[model samples]
Target: MASGADPKFEAELRRGVVQLVALDYLETPRYGYDLVRLLGAAGFPVEEGTLYPILRRFEKQGILSSRWDTEGARPRKYYELSAEGRAQKNAMLGAWAQVRDATDEALKRSMEAGQVGSPDGAEEETTS
Candidate 1:
């Protein structure tokens, strides 16, 4: 009985926040396409539709600061995390750690019972 969806898959509720997440991943300012590819390599796999809007929104919200870089034939907007954004990312990371720990424990128990598909989910490859 195959439904349209894969039972092993799950959607990230963190939808529009990849820009903030990307900021934490970057050591310095990054332009739009660079940020997209970087996150994809890191396994977040952001689409341009999702990332570009978030970048603009974060810039508007003061969590990001941007400047025009004209080194190329055409200019591009480069984004860096503002002081407030860095502080917020730190706080979010702390909360995410707690969630991850709790989820890991639950998955461990479920795996022991053969209850869920992937015991470690996305964390498996990272672990070993």
Candidate 2:
């Protein structure tokens, strides 16, 4: 019932994967802006306002650690994954893989049954 640009669907999808992607990038120390650039380059496209809060939450949860870097003209907080963060990332990745496989299987079945879009983008019906 929703269109392609449905805000609710977009929010739900992003919320589900943001943490996993963030953790993946935090494997290396990076500042907030750097994360925005890197993640955007990787097709994530997270805004600074969205990312900083997530970083803070991860830090509070002991999944990330941060240090102040003053080497540049301005100071920045660099974040890296903690030991626990690495373990959590691995677990999340495994769970994501399972979810992806299950969803793909369900979609394939739906398409085969003509309950959804066909390979040519046409709606199909099953005859009894």
lDDT of 2 by residue, 54-120 (tens): 8999999999999999999999999999999999899999999999999999988877776454666
| Least accurate 10 contiguous residues by lDDT in model 1 | 7-16
Over the stretch 1-128, how does candidate 1's per-residue lDDT look in tens digits?
Answer: 23456534423444534544786865488888999989888757778897888778878888789999999988988889889888877887787788789999997877765543355464333333
| Model 2 lowest lDDT segment of ten | 114-123
Q: TM-scores, in order shown?
A: 0.71, 0.83
lDDT of candidate model 2 versus the reference: 0.87
Q: What is the lDDT of residue 56 in candidate 2?
A: 91
TM-score of predicted structure 2: 0.83
RMSD of each: 9.0, 4.4
